[model samples]
Target: MAMAKLVVTAVLVEGRSKSEVARDYGVSRRWVITMVQRFLAEGEAGLRPRSRRPRSNSRRTAAAVEDEIVELRKRLTEQGLDAGAATIGWHLGQRHGQAPATATIWRVLTRRGFVVPQPHKRPRSSYLRFVAEQPNERWQADITHWALADGTDAEILNIVDDHSRLLVGSVARSTFRAADVVACFHQAAARHGFPAGLLTDNGAVFTGSYRGGGWVALERELVGLGIRLTHSRPYHPQTCGKVERFHQTLKKRLARQPRAATLDELQTQLDTFRAHYNTARPHRALGRGTPQQAFDTRPKAAPTAAPVTVPAHYRVRRDRLDTTGCVTLRHNSRLHHIGLGRRHAGTRVLVLVHDLHIRVLSEDGELLRELTLNPSRDYQPQPKP
Candidate 1:
């Protein structure tokens, strides 16, 4: 617009020739003539910029198809199902025998104001993703908190298959205990078969290593079943990314439904969601195939009877608690201060380092304090009961 105004002014007001104005502005002579004609006929309004969009697109998605996409998005959202472009495209294909490409569906959603731009989100390519090669190769487990209609807090334990993105189990309770985790694992394994390995965070219910390197009930059960067990590094949830990501999806669906009044009600909702997620909803990571399809099509991996060995970085070092009742231990070139309480100051202790897991014992070999070191921070404070 500014260039057009400048060209018109130079020709009409400055008494410049059309050829001279076009030559000076580096625009074509025909463009200069068209701008002068527009300024003369419609005044300044004619000098405003016009859209470069084509007058008509013969290959554009049909209005009816676009309407169906919008309708599907709305219906799926209302039903608490995934309404992403890939899932929507799968639905369209299933219903009409043909569907627009995933990119086309995304463009239509954006044009209809259904998609929000998130430029600050990290790109998926930058992530170092690890996936299981086949179904039952590994399973990731995690617990997330939710609220009931009465404002009471509830914990939902989610177990997901690493290869197929299947929600093998989703159980809700007022609070989850080590026993509950073991029971849930058994139930999920009974249905989907045992996985070769289980991945989880350093939650106490999942592992007793945080206490004194003893296996918890779930860990013992996994060992008895010959399934390997692994815990994510402290303060690092990415190792169990699959199940952590599933928690977000589950919570989204739960948020769309009416808040449950009881644990049983919440469990019912979870059961329904797990069925739909495993059998109906298309998984974006699996080329839009449902989890059940992916799981069934692949060969299952069996549990290995390999013995658990100490981590490569495992070491025991002697140290005395400083006046602040904190003992510092360095692992991976980073120092971490473990709090053992003020009374234990000046006491001799052994700092055991197993990767990021830590345990402090008195000189007599009595366990004094144990925790997972949060490498992001220097001080590891005693967790609140």
Candidate 2:
């Protein structure tokens, strides 16, 4: 409109034809003629800036309502919950009874920094969406590196239930050894009931010192508890994404605030974080509800106790060891001196580790002793020093 008016003024004031004015000012001849007539009548007032505000603001959200929507979006985003306009509107209506329209929510969201531009290139799409039907049905485990104030790397092993997002275990360990993980698993199982399935990466700890081949002693134990052990494929961290994301949340949004003094000190912080993560922190998958909410709202379909079944080929042997913790097992006509180490005198034991050996667990399910064929090499790794 302004360009047309300028062309008309040029054509009339300079005594130029429409084509000449159009050529001079670069506007169409018809527009130049039409605007020149309008200018002749309405004068310079016809060349004023148009009103930017909509003629009718009927669709606009009220200032108070818009402010409320913005505030809610900020809060939800800070809590790591879904802050999309549609989600915010639903929440504000259903949860807070705002009953505002989606457009209002969107305007508020954009005004209050609730949206971000999509990245140019994102990771390849994932098809695997973990759905745990019941609590303790399946759990994911991983280890991450933390640091003490002294700058020493601390290996933190974490285990969390897939369904509940419960932090079953998060302990500081010097090494991510299979035996070390076994100890932590025992601690976690003692608190929460034994899981039916364990999901972990193909790290040395999960697959054992010797990789491949079904599973090591740790897998065997999980199998005994009626638990299925599955390993994420190598170079595929997304296979164990639940625990991986948990680690991300733990390090970035939560615990990077303070300096930790020691591993024990870090563990204390972990415990506090675990409580909040389970009960307070909202999960995007859980419809903006916490893990505890999902866990509690859902029914339990998992076993309360560990699976203790022996393999079909394996035969059960109930035996007793002497006061010296040595057991005499008749295998291939050889009396094997399995070291019980003065711990199991007259206890019923099951041989789970290897042939020509037995392990005794007390009435309280305590590992009373492990009678090993090679006692010297059992707990003691050969030392170079």
Candidate 3:
């Protein structure tokens, strides 16, 4: 527009030739003549630039559909549910015959100020993530703290399937002990079947390795059922990132509700949230399908063997032969003494055991004794003592 006005002024005011003005401004003589003609006809108004946008956009989403998207966002936000583009699209598809693409929904949201741009946030593509291939392949368990009406803190233990992100269990307790963790896991297992593996942090209730290299009740329960128990590195919460993230989402919803005065009230809220999360709310990671839907879409994985009532692995110990020529070991929470003859009394030995097959080795690496342990007997009589 500035160039056009300059050329027209040079031509009309200075009485310059069209060719001269065109040459001075590096514009075509035909363009100079046209601008001059438009200037003469319409004055300064004709010098303003016209829009280059198309007269019509047939591929654009309908205004009614955009209104529906905005309405869905407003409703979901009011309900304390996810209002993301994928979720909006999921709801839109349900209400309308066809739904716009997620990108389109995002654009509408941005234009309407329903979405904020997060330029500094990390992109999902840059993340290295792992998910189980089948439902029940792995379960992630974590505990989060919440406050009650009386200002007392309560704990909510949550269990989520790694593959489907299903909320298998959400229990509200004043405090969670090792026994409570085992009971919660059992309740979830009874409903969804046992998972192939269980993942958790090195919390005292979840594991006892940090205490004295012994198995906690929860760990013992999983191991006895042929389910692999795994713990994230100490202080590294990202190893159990999925459950940690779920805690954030769950708390966001719970924060909007009235504070519960009792454990039962909190448990009721948890049950309501769990039901909606599993069957109604759309999950962004699951391609907008509910967790229950995703879980039901795949075949569930099971433990390698049927869950048993007894332990599967025995602990290995190092001890010196007693003065009475016997080595005692704890098996299945019971102590059993093995006879090693009076000659080897006071000698150090290594007890290597797997199930009932026990091997005793001398400190010098000699195989001192090998026998099948008889758990029924407290003392194994020495042969030919």
Which 10 consecutive positions of candidate 2 have the poorest summed lDDT?
376-385
Error of 1 at 148 (Å): 3.0
lDDT assessment of candidate 2: 0.69
In the range 203-241, model 1's lDDT, one tens digit per residue, is 989876577545566765665566777779899888888
Between prediction 1 and prediction 2, the one with superior lDDT is 1
Question: What lDDT does candidate 2 reach at residue 199?
Answer: 94
RMSD of each: 10.7, 12.9, 9.4
Q: After superposition, how far is residue 370 of candidate 2 from its true place, in Å?
A: 27
Sort all candidates by TM-score, best to worst: 3, 1, 2
Q: Over the stretch 246-312, how does candidate 3's per-residue lDDT look in tens digits?
A: 9998988887789899999999999999999999888888887889999999999988743434324
Q: Name the candidate that leads on TM-score.
A: 3
At residue 28, candidate 1 shows an lDDT of 100
Better of 1 and 3 by TM-score: 3
Provide the lowest-lDDT 10-residue window in model 3. Answer: 305-314
